[model samples]
Target: VAVTIPVSDDPTLPCLTFRFWVLATIFSILAAAVGAFNFLRYNQIALTTFAFILMSYPCGLLMAKILPSWKIGFYWPSDFLFARGTFIGGSLNPGPFNVKEQTLIIVAASTNLGAAYALDILSIQRLFFGPNQNPNNVGWAASLLLLWTTQCLGYSMAGLSRSWLVYPAAMWWPTNLVTANLLHIFHSDLQQEVVRDRLAVFKKITVLALVYELLPQFFAGYLSRISLVCLALGGASGKLGIAADYSPGRGTGVGIVTLDWAGVSQLGPLYTPLWAQMNVLISLMVSSWIFTPLLYVSDFWNAKSYPITSTGTFDNEFRPYDVSRVIDLQTHDLVVAKYDAYSPLMLNPAWAIVYAAGFAALSATLVHVFLFHGQELAEGFRSSRNPESEDVHVKMMRKYPEVPFTWYLATLVIFAALSIFLVEYWNTEFGMRWWGVLLAIAMAFIFLIPTGIILAISNATIGTNIIVELIYGFIDPGKAIANTVFKTYGFNSLHQAHALASDLKLGVYMKIPPKAMFISQFYGTIIGSIVNYAVMDMLIRNVKQIWYFTHHSPLAIDNHWNAQNPPVFYTASLIWGAIGPQRFFSGQYSVLYYGFLVGAIAPVLTWGLHRRFPGSGWNYVNFPIFFQYWGKAQSNGFANCLVSGFAASLTSQFWLKRHHRTWYDKYNYTVSAGLDSGSMFTAIIIYLV
Candidate 1:
């Protein structure tokens, strides 16, 4: 903590001042709009929190310079003839744009950095399923309620887990450390030689990255993924028998390399721990290069008959399954006779392994956290209750009043009730009972701490989407809406909770008031949710060709707005909801069921091995990360950036950390922030131009 985050406090600094509110609100709206707009694009660009951090500083300083310092007051007039008014006044601009104000603005904007997860549920529903596939049929009230409830429920969970997740120094979120460090550099005394040097480096890198991005992103796109093996084999469609094996654009991307920082930094090589990166690389090598190739060559599950990598489900004849044929038009459920007469659902080898890996990753997270970090978590929980055991950062934060527990509790209750009401009252459309809401919440709550622990330390997360789909699939099979709604509530709530927790820890590090942090995040979430729904509605209604499954549009040319996510989402609904996991996981896919058991056992064995050989670095082999990344390439497409990612990780984390400690400490995170900011800026510019 001392090495990464400054141990200091200046309580008098203005946090929720007039300038802060104006900037926060503006950035919050912008972030939401940008996030939602890019979500449907083929090459999706996340307007990352680093971008928020970089952009907000200048805007805050500009506002501080331009806005008047004169006091502005709110007045309410009395009804009497001799009227009197109650007045509240504050300066238009706060003293100076301090760290607290900057932190609040960043937090607010960052909260809405991506489109709401519930939008996926809405997209799949409107684009692919049922009579309501038409955007006009989807009700605004129901959509808003679904979006807001799922987005907010996690705030409650985040509040409930704050003691263990945020206050404890042991649960240090690695990602936030980068944010904190960059913010400190931005706000530090520029007069200092060291600070000036660091800032210069940051600026130079940002410009260099921006200029370099154009080469790969535009002029020579082939520079993004250069595969020597593919060239050696002749080409993407070479006459060589195994030409597809090394084609990064169409195949598994074995031995592919990327010169683009945007591609290399996708997995956060500079920031994520070396062990975590290694685990992912090891898993990728074994699964994509070795295991998947072996399976494809052997025609495992008749893999050679279909594309080596595809998210779309296939029919027995090896074509894209025509979902409309098996689904009833009116009821929207699977027509048993049609499905039986048609053919069983088929998955490519890679996609099948992706599901199996997802199952293992989820179960492995629970067991891993239980066996390894269980004791530390217990202590943190107890320490949270007893404030005397607080660390320096938490101790410093005690001067400011904390957000009351009841605030989160009340918010949780209100949203939870609204969720239940929507599902039950609109059961015809949602296809979920009130109990399903409860079940979804229960699942989110169960995995919160376990997943939080992994994310905090490793900068890697294990999602509950697969497990939630599987469990709910069995409980309420043949209802696509129910599966999607349940998955949204279950998966998104947990995800949002962790996002809140991460920001809260950032607040702790920065000494921002807990109440101010809560307000910023809560407000951002509401604003983002509204903007997300509005954008989704507009796109669905106006776009001539949105999804390829329904129709193709010019926007899909060169994969601009091809609508990749919705198809994958729609496929999961069919596999897990309409066809039912019970049927889909039977016969040929029965081996997938063992994934859960394998996931559970792998962690136990690792834990035992660590105990037996404490010095062997056994503890660093996180099974959850390994399993999660094992089949990541199948869903994420070819391993186009794997070589570059590994190179960056080793260069920064291994070589620089050991050989050039001083330069690494002062400039590593700044470089990361600059590169990300530059790449994002370039992408946004490219889109607009």
Candidate 2:
């Protein structure tokens, strides 16, 4: 039963506004490329994350006016918006811009962030500044190509046999639904019958939001900081003060009245579905809100001396710890005498517990996959071998000749071979071995299917960095660079694979050409890699004291880009490379290792209960996902987000979705777009001023 939607007798696809789209896309790339380079030098990562779609909103509005008057093409802005069911339209609907190219440009812009991030953590952070005694001496060419190839090799695999994960509607990647609707909101036909005035609603909301934002963002911004506790106890966070450092973000309990939505979302506020948000918030309440406070108050792991919400390593005397000074220059191992003189690598009680829980999470992910997806995996592979006789998405896709699996094989081999070549040939101070590189790739391949399955079901993908770190930790204990590079390959490659797979699904639904999709993903990644490195390099050379101050620095307490995720990568390099996991996980912190067993068994037990009582609701409990969301960040990272994020989730995912499905679907993505666009645009202005 191959049900297909018949198209009208049209020769070729409509080129609504070709010139404007080209110009808009070029401007977007140029803006992101140049802005990411110059702006992120002084500003935080947030400034560079300006949503292209948000930028598109204003541009599309502008084009609607200009394209009609210009008298350029055959269809001079006749039907400004196309009712493709995937995009939204407006008054004039805009001529030059359409949905297909919109996806391409946004996808291209997205490609910038990952490569910069990975390289910054692995090579750039060390080679230029801190930690590594003898930094990697590889030139620009070597670094750029290496990063580009890895992303390409892994991502290309997703294109070859994407049917199983994509075709089945059951594997509804909920995030994409949100994205599709957002695109629909952007490219939708305003004159259509189903529901008109959607664009008007977007405009109304956006204007109101922008006007309201002006108050908190610029004039009398004190409204943004409406916490009573912080106002009351302005200056008393001393050791014995009753304030207990109970400032809004500084102290414990939930920071209420922090009403800045963009500040809260910073990265993922708008897009994260209510379901995933609820799960994460529940875990945060358990971990950070309730448990963390208790542990900190009790002075667990010398919490009294350290900030309650950080992963900063502390000395036994509660002084901040640094690994660079502790490493022996010749041996790359910790000097035992100095280490003995120093305090053991200690963390805030909150993060210490998370490390343990993270281990449990890794095992839990594997176990949950086996329990839930084991049967489906076999069936999916068998069915996908030929796209034989199932879902209409599969049958429809069967029309286009699939990219040969051997191409995927060749891609993986070629790029991976290049990666290994960089390691063996460059042989820089990183000390990455050939075997270690292969093992990382092997690890990525091993987990890709299961993790991909997990990501497809629920848009959340639990990172396996800890597992990869643990593996290489044992292999090259004293080699920080090796361990970091290994983890990047193992974890990030699959991370990229997930991205490509999702894009493929997006292309499928949108009916974009597969070959075109592959070209965009593969080449977009290469461009992104080059631009990311170029941006990172320029910023590093230009900015002074701009690099991330490690946990050891007193200045790291500030809420800046440096205090964010990069430090975690640096810490892993030190912990896994400098100190070695054996000394921590298997020795002094031996309890962390057992987390794997705890994780493995718990899910198995849950599965047994599900089998025992079919209707007992055991199946609904995703304990693995629960554990995966259990980890927290250092202070200023997710601390502020938890409380506000919880409330927002409850409002959106729970109350609104349950009560007002029609309204929620119609307006959710639009509201999100307004917030993201308004805030980002405002933030950029704020930076410029």
lDDT of 2 by residue, 25-78 (tens): 454455446544543333543433236666655665566557554333334344
**lDDT by residue for model 1 (504-618), tens:** 9999999999999998888888887888889888987887467653455445554566776777777677778888888787778989878888999999998999999999999
**Poorest lDDT segment (10 consecutive residues) of candidate 2:** 1-10
Per lDDT, the best of the predicted structures is 1
Misplaced by over 4 Å in model 2 are 1-11, 14-42, 45-50, 54-96, 121-136, 220-250, 255-257, 263-275, 297-305, 329-333, 384-395, 544-568, 586-588, 613-616, 631-636
Please provide TM-scores, in order, for all candidate models, with all chains considered together: 0.93, 0.82
lDDT, model 2: 0.62
Off by over 4 Å in 1: 43-46, 75-89, 129-136, 231-250, 383-391, 547-549, 552-561
Model 1's alpha-carbon lDDT is 0.82
In order, the Cα lDDT scores of the candidates are: 0.82, 0.62
